[model samples]
Target: MRKLANRPGGPKGAAIIRRGWGKVLGGLTLSPLMAVLLTPPAAAQSADISQKVKAECAACHTETGNSIALPFPKLAGLAPDYLAKQLRDFVSGARKNEIMFPIASQLSRADITALADYFSRQKRTPAMVTKPQLLAAGEIVFHQGNKENGVPACAGCHTRNGAGAPRFPMLAAQNPDYVVQQLQNFRSGARTNDFGKLMRTTVSRLTDDEIQAVAQYIASVPPPAGR
Candidate 1:
């Protein structure tokens, strides 16, 4: 937020970054929230599952899945449904992050569910505020969804309310810088775990204006109920 120029995961305009796609789509699972209501022994099973995930992922993901540094996304309070979908996507080759592929690959359905459940319940720190001008631009893109460019509204998937379903994350309140980085990743194929291949195609067409507008808009909005 403090004009992080040239910093790691710094502002790189709207270019894409490519990474592995096929290796990310093997370990798929449903969200804990859903599993809990659906499964008979969800509570006890989920507790054990969450513990296992922490032990495995905490080394790099840090406590509560919130990284202290830049570039790494703050996983605390992410939407469980979104997280579960991503883990599945990474395994299924729909999404492709170099770091995420291997980690996701090792996860079992239970592990993915537990991780999503844990992180989705944590709180998201605020996105650093910078480039108000850019954020203003990002707003238009988010609400409008760039029909001319064939991009759908982000709210459609993440939900306008920001109470994302079991696997779609609540983008509201996330770091604009992080969002920008992800968009660039999606555009360039760096982070492809985007649902339905929509983000990849949509992000690819996003201009500097669109990126700034969408990211800012998402950051400006407050998380919805249950987020």
Candidate 2:
């Protein structure tokens, strides 16, 4: 056999090693650049969704879904699944709202999903509290139910801070008027979309004053961080 170390620092061996290292280094240098080039930006992906929200939803909910108006509920920080379900309910006549029904009817399922995702990620602004007394009264109801009236603690389902679960909605910082209206709706059978009539049952025994107090309390509470 030929002496292995004798020719041009073993030309074929050195050349092969150099080529292999060059390929490895090239790949390492280019990998991140290639990823950046190939991947679409997050903002770019949501651009169309943002436009759609601006055109259709911003009029009432605002661009960030943090509407301050009593007539419109804030959509920010709500669970995406809940938002999507509400949109679908409006479309299907399960939730009756003349304004929302028409708008929701125009949207495709994909549009609803996109809107839900967009709004759910937005930060929620705190709702202004105008009634400290009502808020105090509501806080009691929220944290501890009226056992005499057979009412369960709102926090039991909505969490102590009102962060809410996947199915239950976040009630903290919700518009007081909107919350009251929903409770009335649930009590009167005007809105029946709640799973297993939970809202209806919960609100059934609550007096008008209790409802108002709870709504005021919910409106006054601050949302969880990033919610």
Give the residue spans of candidate 2 off by over 4 A. 1-45
Model 1 residue 204 distance off true place after TM-score fit, in angstroms:
3.0
The per-residue C-alpha lDDT of model 1 at residue 145 equals 78
Report RMSD (Å) for each prediction in the order shown: 22.9, 7.7
Note the Cα lDDT for every prediction shown. Answer: 0.70, 0.89
How many residue pairs in model 2 have overlapping backbones? 0
Worst 10 residues of 2 by lDDT: 1-10
Q: What is the per-residue lDDT of model 2 for residues 1-227, given as tens digits with 9 covering 90 to 100? A: 25675444696768778888778767675565665564587754477688888899999999999997886899999999999999999999999999999899999888889899989999999997766789778988999989999999999999999999999999889998899999999999999999998889989999999999999999888989988
TM-score of each: 0.65, 0.80
Error of 2 at 81 (Å): 0.5
Residue 219 in model 1: shift from native, Å? 2.6
